[model samples]
Target: AAAVGATKQELTLSIAIVSLFSLLFLLAEPYAAMGLGLSDDVAGAWIGGTVDLTGGVVAGAAVVSARCEEVAAIIKMTQNSALGVYILLIAVLASRSGLGGKDAASPAPPAKGEGLVYGLWKKFPKFVLGYLFCSVVASSLADRERGIAVPLLGGVARWWFAIGFSGLGFSTSFRSLREQLDGPNVLVHY
Candidate 1:
């Protein structure tokens, strides 16, 4: 009975962790996509309709570009959901399998905090890869003629946003945030 209870608890925790991470991931995708899409649209409109207002057009373009960066940051943050899920899944599985179970008399938690650092480091590669991809896409789009790049970038951005927003719909909750802030550790921070 105890084992069954423990298993059920672990499974519930696992699902919660997965759902949260997935939600974060979903939010980020749309944020990035919308930024990209808006950038493309604004740039197109300014360039096409404001031939006489060169200064205004340039200013608008610059603003749009900054929006892209903001979106990219949001997207990167959302992507961090993957790491969150991985960590939680590992923890739950390890505990449930008796690898770190109290009954198994497992040794004390590591003193070095190596696991946390290593896990973060493992995620660095993906972050770096994402940055590289963004850089390549940005450069390619910038160098090409506006007509050639706008449609493609716009489409890609739309897809990213749609997927992210859909995921967010499934995962976000004001109640979860309220509960998190009620925790002892959060109180200590205040």
Candidate 2:
């Protein structure tokens, strides 16, 4: 009934709000678990082991303390950050080209290939040098017990995760959403 009466714009806004809320809710548990340092299995165990309401709550908290053993999160975060940097650099180049539009026949592609190589080198060049920076350095200097790299990597990963999320949000707009809502006629499969 609400959808029937609402304007296209209003309906689109409603959908966006609902979708964002749903996504946040869905991610809450995993984010909490990641923050807590508990593996999913350990979190499950803690939750299942407890009986009282407080126990359940504490179990949830415990999950947050469990460190993630998965390397996928770190890799994904790095990939996302690299992608974001590439996009940002492209946007900057596009804007500069647009400003130069009056003087040029067509905008030339920025020397992004060189920039990308240089950027990658600047970002992680030490890895190729065999110098063993960061985690390796910490491990070598402080011993394995003191040099756990997860925390440091996790912090960097979270920062990139935020950048990726922010980039995604920036690309979303009400106009595109309205178009999608109005085009739902195509959604019918029958």
Q: In candidate 1, list every pair of residues with a backbone clash.
A: 30-161
lDDT of 2 by residue, 1-190 (tens): 0102234344345545554544443346546556677666655443333222222333344434433223323333344336444544554544444321222222233345555344333333232233224436555665564546657765785687569557656756867775656565423311
Q: Best candidate, TM-score-wise? A: 1
- Model 1, residue 52: what's the lDDT? 22
Pairs of residues clashing in candidate 2:
36-64, 36-65, 36-66, 37-64, 37-65, 37-66, 37-67, 38-66
Go through the candidates in order and give each one's C-alpha lDDT. Answer: 0.43, 0.43
lDDT tens digits, residue span 1-190, model 1:
1222233234333445444544443434334434556555444343323222222333333444565334443444444435445555554444344343233213322235546444333322243455456547766765456557767766886687669656655665546644654463432422
Q: How many residue pairs clash in each candidate?
A: 1, 8
List TM-score per model, in order: 0.31, 0.28
Count: clashes, candidate 2: 8
Q: Alpha carbon lDDT of residue 84, candidate 2?
A: 42
Residue 188, candidate 1: alpha-carbon lDDT: 42
